[model samples]
Target: MTITTPNNSFNATLQDLIEYPANGINSTVLLKDNNSQYSLFCLAAGTNIDEHTSTRNAVITVIEGSGNLNLEGKDIALTPGVFIFMPANAPHAVQAKENLAFTLALSEHLPAKKGVSQKTIDIVKSTAPVIKQHGKTITTRMYEIMFDTHPEVKSQFDMAAQANGTQHAKLATAVYSYATHIDDLESLKAMVDKIAHRHVATHVLPEQYPIVGECLLKAIKDVLGDAATEEVMTAWAEAYQALAGVFINREQQIYQNAS
Candidate 1:
């Protein structure tokens, strides 16, 4: 198969580029860049690609084919027009029940800003004790401010939880945990994953992060008063953005896979 590097935009009919081998798969690299790649793949009937994992995220769009895609141990039927997304490192395999052709796109994962600075982590961690003590108060005030200013977001939350104070308690716990784990994020992986999934279920949009962050910072200042120094606020702001970036990226992947 030929691989070409284009210095300018190029277009072609994907179907015309397919080449099916009698007993194996054939592939052509259509385009490649610093962080992404696109390829076309064709497999003869009965051919298969063994289960494997990719370092980068990938999407497969069936152009003209019938197959079965085994993604993360779940089988999904593949036919013309079917699209599948696989997150980075998800185990997957493909078998061509009939002659199959598809386009594969791969993308590198862009992690949020190489993590918060050491000073930011130290500052945030130092405030963990105070955050733990006043966490619920700050989160409750945050929700009030947010609902008063952006009432549209109220629909995404559970009013019952809010009324009973469970929502505030949960946020407080999460914030305190985050502050304590600021330097060792891996310890908080389960919490992060759970929250990311919950965010997706609630259809949280990326744009709303800034609103929540602003309200949270203001609430902290209001509740902590003179204790919330400029340096502390700055560190928390940076830390919050870093945490938001992680959730945004994870939710985006979940959304793509659902689509």
Candidate 2:
């Protein structure tokens, strides 16, 4: 399912990079203009792209693969159809469990400046302090807490997880990532468009938005416990509403565009 728009410049071809040993990760740049960048990367089982940070926020979609994404400090399992937002200048890393392919899109419009890339071990030394102090890191913890406390929400993902399809995992990661990087309205819009398309594929009704909302609230409550202040919950809820609204609006636009 390749989507080429009149305004989109993304271009690339999937290739076999490894066979016997299934080692190393390779990337083929799809688009690299002044305003935006895109690429497809292939990785072999057990391969990794050690902890690294980017200057701009990146939206990553797992096209085909099994892997675990370490964002901030939490581990997120990723598979095909999953999307994850890597916030600007945030320390992140990847570990591939099987042959995998993924796509990444980054906006040049964000304000953050880039720092030098460090190896996986050296990464903590450079960015750990800031990540620990930053509020954004809490979201990763909240995700784990949410899943642990609200096992019912896990039911929403059972079918996919059982089949190793990572659609829900991707949506969750992308939503969290985009929420943390809301400085650019366009980035948010792109995130919405992606989510809308994903919903169409999964037959996800608009009503599922509330289910996700409740799961998020539960996660926050579990993570922060008594400290889950009203102000904090409200802010997160507002972000969720905005993101869901984008999904709904874009879904409508997609129908209109088709007609």
Query: Using TM-score as the measure, which candidate wins?
Result: 1
Task: Give the RMSD in angstroms, all C-alphas superposed, for model 1.
Answer: 16.7
- What candidate 1 gets wrong by more than 4 Å, as runs, is 1-110
lDDT of candidate model 2 versus the reference: 0.60
Residue 195 of model 2 has an lDDT of 66
Model 2, residue 158: what's the lDDT? Answer: 48
Model 2, range 18-82, lDDT digits (tens) per residue? 22244786666665544566777778888978766664579988878688999999998898889
Give the Cα lDDT of each candidate.
0.88, 0.60
Give stretches of model 2 more than 4 Å off. Answer: 1-22, 112-259
* Model 1 lDDT, full chain set: 0.88
Residue pairs in collision within model 1: none
- Model 2, clash count? 1
**Which tens-of-lDDT digit does each residue in 85-108 have in candidate 1?**
998657789999999999999885
CA RMSD of each candidate after superposition: 16.7, 19.4
- lDDT, model 2, position 212: 63
